[model samples]
Target: MKKQEQDHQKKNPIYQEYQLNLNLYNKGKTQLGIEFLI
Candidate 1:
């Protein structure tokens, strides 16, 4: 995930778009984790 995100950042240096995608990715990860925990 870290490696993929790094590659994505390099592909898209636009801070706003990168941040948005990162936020969404993080939220998805959180949801998955919660489901796994449950």
Candidate 2:
């Protein structure tokens, strides 16, 4: 059941988009942190 859900997530467009946005948010956070440190 867990495996099936993971496979479904892999195929889900919304889930994929959320993941992309999450990655971008993390990268932006890192850049902001570096600017604050400098």
Q: Whose lDDT is greatest here?
A: 2
Q: List the residue pairs that clash in candidate 2.
A: none
**Which portions of model 1 show Cα errors greater than 4 Å?**
1-13
TM-score of each: 0.61, 0.81
State each model's CA lDDT, in order. 0.87, 0.97
lDDT (Cα, tens digit) per residue for candidate 2, span 1-38: 69999999999999999999999999999999999999
Instruction: Report the lDDT tens digits of candidate 1 across residue range 1-38.
Output: 59998787678759668788899999999999999999
